[model samples]
Target: MVALTDEEKAMRDGRDGDAVAAAMDLLIRYADALGAEQLCETRNVAGTNTQPSPAKTKLFEEGGWSKAFSVISLDCDDDIEVPQMKVPTCQLQHGFGNDALGIMPYSERNIELQAGAESFYSSKGVNVLATCTPYQVGNLPTYGEHIAWMESSAVVYANSVLGARTNCEGGASTGSASITGRIPCWGNHLVENRYGTHLIESGLRMTGFQDWGMFGYFVGDMVQEARPVMIGDLGQPDLADLKHFGAAAASSGGVEMYHIPGRTPDAPTLEAAFGGAAPPESLHYGEAERRAIYDSLNSIGNSEDVDFVLIGCPHASLEQIGRVARALEGRTLSAGTELWVMTPRALRAVSDRNGWTATIERAGGRVLTDSCPAMSRVAPAGTKVFATDSAKQAHYLPAILGIEAWFGTTEECVEAAVTGRWRGSLAPAAVVR
Candidate 1:
């Protein structure tokens, strides 16, 4: 059994009522299952609760929000009375909303169900910052802060890029953490496990956003859940580039943490990445490897006649929205083609003020928010083939939607959107001096 403090015991003894006790119960069980010595305190949590599903729908219909929370969130079958969250928590993206009437096949009753759940959860202090990239909006966790977060891409970004600590948590665990403010102190939460397990070196310059995604996919595939130490002829990558990279890595492999020495916060040097131990033999991500990864991501596609172009997966940064808008400013989408840019609603508002939203909309593209097509398994009606700049999306959409996917740069995707054909060709590799 995992050791619990007096305070934790008090919560379990029902000092804070049934919901918290149940949450505590779940946390203790979770900690023990992980072989964790104790539960660590956490103030940040991100999870999903509002996505409409047959199970949640039935639960809500039978016993309302409390029953749903007890069963779904707390993993308890008891109809416990839910209470306000004990710590700061936010809802992750829950899929396209009711506003997607003409565009998506999401049912009206399901939309209503989602709205009701969102209203109920918000009243209980769950911030409905409905975006996959919560860090992009607010809720940026401090380096080394223990957090309970869902979403594989966000978990990897928190650990590898922002230096925060989190495992790829699930709904029940994050829900439990939200109420009790405690999580299992195993995996990425510990300093010892944060050290690099694999070393990746690249002499080929990986500077562009596309290159970052490809390199991340390669690293993730090679490491396959192991922590990686990366040293390369990589140019200075910006926020969006790293965002794309981390998301791709998490999707291709279950990479929850990595160290880019001198770039990522945890590892300032090669030695530091390995905790003073000698680094492993470097795994090279050279031209052949990059090409192989690209082909793998694109292998699902056969038709050149593109029907949809999706621009964001971990949610687009403001600059990415602007880039799409700029590319589509004077052009209209092809007759049969549709384009969508997924971003945080907050960023979408910023994009609106910057006129990027207007530009893209005018060119027959949408600036969507609060959810992703992959999570919903919903795309434009009759979308058999899609193009995207996100390696993560390219990796997932094919499997989820049973659609062909073309992986390329944002410009190439936009061109595909405009012409309704996949004319994209990989650029000749450029070496960074």
Candidate 2:
């Protein structure tokens, strides 16, 4: 029932090319699955989670590039040449990093495979900027612009912070949308679906990234799928704070969008956020609730002996990298501890230019790019304990790596990285509201 333009119909009918036809067919099925009545043009920006793997390399080696493209991209049994993307598209974070800079522990074969994948995508007109925070780089989507992004944290950020429209696009859907320059018109694409269903009022004076992360964790858990308009007594948060907030919220729950009155682009006022409709219910998040959420996030018990301290779950910004460098300026990590700072290549370039990378490297830390430990799921050998400043990392690392994970402020994580011991307090001395 979805209406397609003449160009789209030609592609679907194999008039353009086999690859375009196959891609259009898949998109038609996708639109049908979504129960969408039509497809809309998307020219703002698009990103795909089309990362490389060893299995994909094997497929290419066995069946040639065309076969590999159809199998990996179109999910089809037949072979087809992959067409160039119609819109500005980039690759999201994958299991690849700059090996010369010791970004990640990749063997020679791993590096070669990663290079092959990158070359393939690059040849097909896809920018291979492999970072989750595409907005930090040159792939920013403006307010109200439609984007087909796949990463969860990036989806929340594009919607809640930048006011761009997108749902939690998956890898295949994003791939289709990128090639076709269109996605099914549903979910957050429609303005009527962007209203606030719940209201969250916070009592804490949020200051740092960790505080905002915990607040987001609490709200995401409480609100679940409901869109929330946050009305709280909070200080003005910067980009880093909102990044951590959106990352943590998307991690703990399925929150694609949120609203902060007078802060975010879409929500100039609460009434505007909800489209003049009253919120169904409101939840209060005070100091006690914050402490409780923090406790629940920490999976480690009394075993403070830490092995790794990680920072940058959504990949650190330039300002955040500077803070890390400043915190560990004169200090070195413990003999048995390691510190890994994950960030995007663009920001890493900035860090290198500003001497932050050298500062952290001199302090026994490595500034890694493209992937995090959780995504790669390969910690240093014999690592039993892990600590991080990201609530999202704290929630996922233990389950993914089966290790003791600790969550705290960036300062606390630095302290743990230096001493190989966790000495951070969970909450302040304020009474519960």
Candidate 3:
């Protein structure tokens, strides 16, 4: 049984309102299920409460957003009035919105439903960041701060890159945490659980976005769900590089955390990554490993006729969007090809203000926000072979949509969108030891 504090008991015994009590009840059950001895305090939560689905629609019709949130988010059957979040909570990416109308196959009714959910949740103090990357849009949790976050890529980034503590929580757990500010103090919440389980080294220097992703895929395939500490002369990785790396790792091997000896916040040295213990025999990311990972990610593709190109997976940063715009500045997409740069609405606004959106639009590409083709399960009318710069998107879009995927660099993907052909190949760097 999980032990509860005085305040926890008060919430469980209905000292708080019905919604808060329901939230507390859900957290207790979740903690107990995880065999957690206690719950930790958290001030940050990232979850999805605005996504529209058939089940959520039915609940909404039955008792409005309150009923939907109570059942789906709080896991409660009671007709409870959802309250303002007790802690800071942000909504993750949801389904397509009005911006997607006529662009794809998403229905208007679902869009309306999602709009309603956004309005309702926003009124209840939910900061709708509406992207998988809450860190980019300023919902960044402080280092060592306990948080309740979902999205595997974000979880890994928080645990590995940002030095924050979080496990892979579900919508229910995050919703409950938002109201109660408590999460099960197990798994990644405890310091001992954050140590490296596998040691890895990369021989080829990684400076490009896709290089980090390929390296990540190799690591994840090797270590699976275990934490890995990477040590090598791999070149400096930027924000977007780590973003692709983490997302690809999560997609390929369900990696929730990793450490780069001197780069990441928590692991300042190789020894610290392993919690000061003797490090394990380091696995090498060499020529064979890089080739196999790249080929595996591109295995689903046989045709070269590209129809769609997706630029972002964890949502494109402002710099990525600008790069795409610059690449497409004076060019036009192929008559049959379409390209979309998925990003947060906040970044989209910035892109618009910076004229990047106009540049891409003039070149016949789009700067889209909030959702991606994979999340919405809708591409251009007849997309058979698609390409993406993101390894995570390349890994999943094939299985999710039954479409062929081409894994390539951002410039290559943009070139495909313009010429309607797949010319991307593994660079010579993949073979050099």
lDDT of 3 by residue, 1-433 (tens): 8999999999888887998899989999999999999999999999999988789899999999999999999999999988889999999988988888888878889899999899999999999889999999988888999999999989999998999999999989999999999999999999999999999888788859989999988888899999988987887899899999999889889899899988999889988999999999989888778889989989999999999999989899888998999899889999999999999999999999999999999988888888888787889889999999898999888888999999999999999999999999988673334
Off by over 4 Å in 3: 430-433
Best candidate, lDDT-wise?
3
Model 2 per-residue lDDT tens digits across residues 1-433: 7898888898789886777777778778988998888777786444543445666767877885556667666666676777877788888887755543343455556566667767877888888778889889888888999888888899999999999998887766667777778788888989999988899987777867888999999888988876888986677899889999988888888899999999999989999999998766678888778878888988464589999999988899898899899999989999899998889888999999999999999999888888887877767777899999999989898888889988998989999999999988775723324
* Candidates by TM-score, descending order: 1, 3, 2
lDDT winner between candidates 1 and 3: 3
Q: List runs of model 2 lying over 4 Å from the truth.
A: 44-46, 100-107, 427-433
**Cα deviation of 207, candidate 1, in Å:** 2.9
Provide the clashing-pair count of each candidate structure: 0, 0, 0
lDDT of 1 by residue, 1-433 (tens): 8888999999999999988999998888888889999889999999988887789889999999888888999999987888999899999999677657677786778778888989999999999999989999998999989999999989988898899999999989999999999999999999999999999988778759999999999989999999988897687888898888888888888899998888999998889999999998989888789889999999999999999999988899998998999899889999999999999899999999999999998999999988888887888999999999999999998989999999999999999999999988778776545
Task: Indicate whether candidate 1 or candidate 2 has the larger TM-score.
Answer: 1
Off-target runs (Cα >4 Å) in candidate 1 are: none
TM-score of candidate 3 versus the correct structure, residues matched by position: 0.98
